[model samples]
Target chain A: MSPFLRATLTIAAKDLRSEFRTKEAFNASLSFSVVILVLFSFAFDPTSEQMQAISGGLLWLVFSFASALSLNRSFARELQNDCLDALVSAPIPVAAIFLGKALANYFLLILVEITALAVFALFYDTHFAAQLWPILLVIALGTWGMTVIGTTFSALTVNLRMREVMLPTLVYPMLVPALMAAMTLTTDLMNGIPLGGDNLLWLRVLTGFDFIYTLLAMVFIDIVVVG
Target chain B: MRDRIMYVLATLSAALLTWNLYKIFMILPDEKNQGAIYRIVYMHVPSIFTGFTGFFVALAASALYLITKDLKYDAFAAAVTEVSLAFASIVLATGMIWGRIIWGIWWAWDARLTTMLVCWLIYFGYVMLRRAIDEPTQRARLSAVVSVFGCVDIMIVYKSIEWWRTQHPAPVLSVRDGGGMGPGMESPIYWNWLAFMCLASILVMVRMRQESISREIDSLRRMAHAY
Candidate 1:
């Protein structure tokens, strides 16, 4: 295998192994998401038609916050054992480190999201039809964009005091467009709109955003890591 | 002395501002639709221009800092970003008031407002990023990368608004085609924009000087402790 791929997978495997051993990050994010969803359920009249109308938005909100939790711990874990400095000294590309962390975080986020979906379905009488695939597609692309951007910022802020609070404050606002696109697309899909025309236009926007931001993050990762 | 030069610039800025305000209120004609309230445009448009100007200045300073490895340029960039954020907050507040008068709502997720908010938030993140990192080199380099990315993000935010075709008013002030403003309205708006730009420049310079002196004091204290 090429050095880049080898290094990327190595770092990713290390993170996965460690996370599997402790389950600290994953458990926290998953439980926090459930608590948020429950709060949303109580805060709004779950029986109101308005709840159904806004379920997609509420789902995205849960995912956004939960993903933030995972993103923070993704890098913070590396710092806990002085592993980040060791990783930096490795003879591998820094972009690989970013990619590896992002991939792992993406996997964990998907797991959390799926579990949240199951809970959302049970708590609310929302219907899901053949539109599941497109909704999932939007979620995948949206999460990719979110994770890439979030990983970069998390790495940038990892060494700071109060990073746990600062990371979300810094990352969430930048994720607005992705979140907006995801919510809009998911809402339409839930309403059973055909996945064409304006809906496709939104999907294309999300796709373009993912491509551009990922590339941007890759190019700038060196500045973030080395600095 | 540097203080004298700054004071002269400040006096010029104040004089130009006074003249511009007089022209906007006394000389400019009332709009057919907006009546006297349209006058808010004088402040709104100029503030937005100053905000963009401050961002570009930050971008240039960031680039210079990265190229030269100079802490002074980094301080300059950060200072400009801070002032720009202040200007953006004013723009947002004034825009909301104007929107309330015209659109009958306190907030609308229109293209211009939405994009402006995103742009503001990104720089807000930029400022917080600087505050989070303590090492000067790390702070300078990371902030440089951020400022550069932020400049590009601003463009994306602006273009997304146009592409999505949301309810924000179309750009009423573009250099292309001289912004299509009537001569009656154009002159005062142009003058006010110039005055605001000058005011923004003065604020950035003062802030930059303070940052440089603070850094010097910090370094001297560190040296004293080492002895």
Candidate 2:
């Protein structure tokens, strides 16, 4: 395998193994997402129509927050053991490190999203008959975009003086476009809208955003880490 | 000595701003359709223009700092970022108020508003990034990168909002159409723009001087401690 792919996978496997051992980040993210879902359930009127009306937004909200929460902690572990310094000093490419962290974050986000969707379906009577695969694809692309940018910001902020508060402050605003696109797609899928027209337009927008931002992160990650 | 000069410039800028405000409210002709709320255009237009000016100044200063490795240029960039953030805040506030009067709603996710908000948030993150980092070189380099990224993100925000659906009308002041504003309105708007540019320049100059003085004081203190 190429150095980039090997480095990315190695770091990703390390994070996944470490997370599996402690389970702190994953558990916290999952629990927080559930709590957010419960709160949304209580806040909105319990009518099926109202529940369906907001399910997409609620899912994206939970996923966004939960992803931030997980990404913030992902670096904390590395920092605690001077692992980041070691990684920085190593011969591996910095973009691989960023990609590895992002992939780990993507995995965590997918888990949180799946759990949230399950809860949403149970409570809101949401049906996913034909558009399920397409919706999942959108979520995958959107989440990858969010995690790429989120991991970069989180890594930068984690080394700062006010790591806890500054990470989300830096991450949330930049995530708006991805969140908006994800919500739009999710809503379209839930509403059973045809995927070929305006929905495709939004999907294309989401894909375009993912492409641009991911490329940006790749180009800049080395500079950010080393600097 | 520099303080005195800054004070004099600030006073002159303030005076000019007051005169321009008077011209906008008392002397300018009312729009045929927009009526009195159109008066907000004076504040709104100037604030937006000044905000953009501040953003470009920040970008230029950041680039200069990176090239020169000069602390003075970093201070200049930070000053520009601060003033730009202030102008962006004013633009957002005035825009919202204007939207309330014109659109019958307090807030709308239109192209202009969304892009401006995103732009403001990016710089806000930039400022926070600087605050969180304690090392001078790291802070300067990181924030410079962030500022450049912010400029690119601003362009993306502007383009995405335009290409996608949004409530905001197309540009009212495009050069392609021989300028969109009528002759009567253009004169006062131009005057207001000049006034705001002066004001923004004065603010940034004052801020840069203050930061430089503070840095000098800090270095002196460090020397005393070492001795």
Candidate 3:
């Protein structure tokens, strides 16, 4: 494997190992997503016709909020012992470090999204299994999009005074188009809309967004991380 | 010489905007379909035009700062972003007024309006990010990263109408698709675009001066602490 890929995997493994062992942020974000899923039913009648139409929006909203909650912790742990500075000064490439952490974030967020989807299915009686491949496709694309921007901005605001507040404030707006695409696609999937033809446009948009942002984040991550 | 140019830009924009206002209100007649409500286009279109211009400029300035490691470019980027945010606010306010009158709604979740608002929020978050960081180099580096990252939305905002073509009108300014205005009515929008640019230049100049002074103060405090 290329050194860059190796470095990224190593960092991602380190993060996943540490996170899985303690499950501090993982458990918090998972619970956050599940709780929001349950609370959403109270916010609106989940059995209503309108609720069926908007279930996708509600699910993605929970995923985004919970992901932002966890992404902020990606770098917060490094700050514990001035570990961020030490990591930056190490011999590994800066972009690799960003990718590794983003990869780890992607995995954690995916797990949260899957659990959230299961709870949503159980509560709302939505039939996602019939469109399992399409739904998973949307989730994978959308979650990667959110994880990329979230991880980069997590590093961006990690050194700030009000990072707890700043991270979501910054991440949420940037998350819109990706999250919107995700929400729209998810809604259509839940409502039994076909995934190709005219829907091809949204798929293109989601894919394009994921590609462009990942490249931009990688190019700029060095300045944010190493500076 | 710089001061002279500022004066010239300020005087020209003020005069042109006055003439433009009169022309829009007095010279131009109401549209057959929308009547007086359409006049808000003069403000709404130009404000968003200038706002987009400022965002791209900030993007470039941020890229330049990253390449040169120059504090001046960072400050320039910050000033342009903040001033452009003011222009973006005008766009939202005027667009809402026009929408309320023409479409009978204050806002719509249509692609264009929502993406425009997303751009506004992203940049506002940019300003908030800058305020949270105290270290000069770190602030410059990190915020420049974000300035570039946030600009990805501007592209999405620009294409949203073409992409979704829902409630928002198509490219009226460019005569694309079935979406052009009466031949001469659009002249005012183009001229006002220039006027808003001049206005933005004046504000950016004033803001950049403040940014420079703040940088100096920041350095002085650092020096004092060192001593």
Q: What is the interface RMSD of candidate 3, in Å?
A: 0.9
lDDT of 3 by residue, A19-38 (tens): 99999988999898888888
Per-residue lDDT over B1-227 for candidate 1, one digit per residue giving the tens place of the 0 to 100 score:
87787788788888988987887778878887788888888888778888888899899999898789888888889988998899899899998998899999989987668878888988998888888778899889988987887787777676785568778666676575456556678667777778777777788778978887888899999999999
What docking grade applies to model 1? medium
Residue B8 C-alpha lDDT in model 2: 74
Q: Write the per-residue lDDT of candidate 1 for residues A1-227, one digit (tens) a residue.
A: 99898888888888888888998878988899899988986798998878767877888999999988888877777776798898899888999999998888888788889888888888887776668998889889999988998899888888888788778877877787788888888877777775898877778878888898899899889888885
Scoring the B chain of model 3 against the true B chain gives a TM-score of 0.94
Better of 2 and 3 by DockQ: 3
Best by TM-score: 3
DockQ of each: 0.68, 0.61, 0.87
Q: Which residues of candidate 2, in runs, are more than 4 Å off?
A: B1-23, B174-180
DockQ of 1: 0.68
- Alpha carbon lDDT at A104, candidate 1: 86
**Per-residue lDDT value at A198 in model 3:** 66
Taking chain B only, the TM-score of every model is 0.93, 0.90, 0.94
- Among incorrect, acceptable, medium and high, the docking class of model 3 is high
Local accuracy of candidate 2 as per-residue lDDT tens digits, A40-142: 7678676657766666777788888888778887677778678889988988889888898888788878987887778767876787667789878978988
State the local distance difference test value for candidate 2: 0.80
Q: Can you tell me the CAPRI class of model 2?
A: medium
10 residues in a row with least lDDT, candidate 1 chain B: B173-182
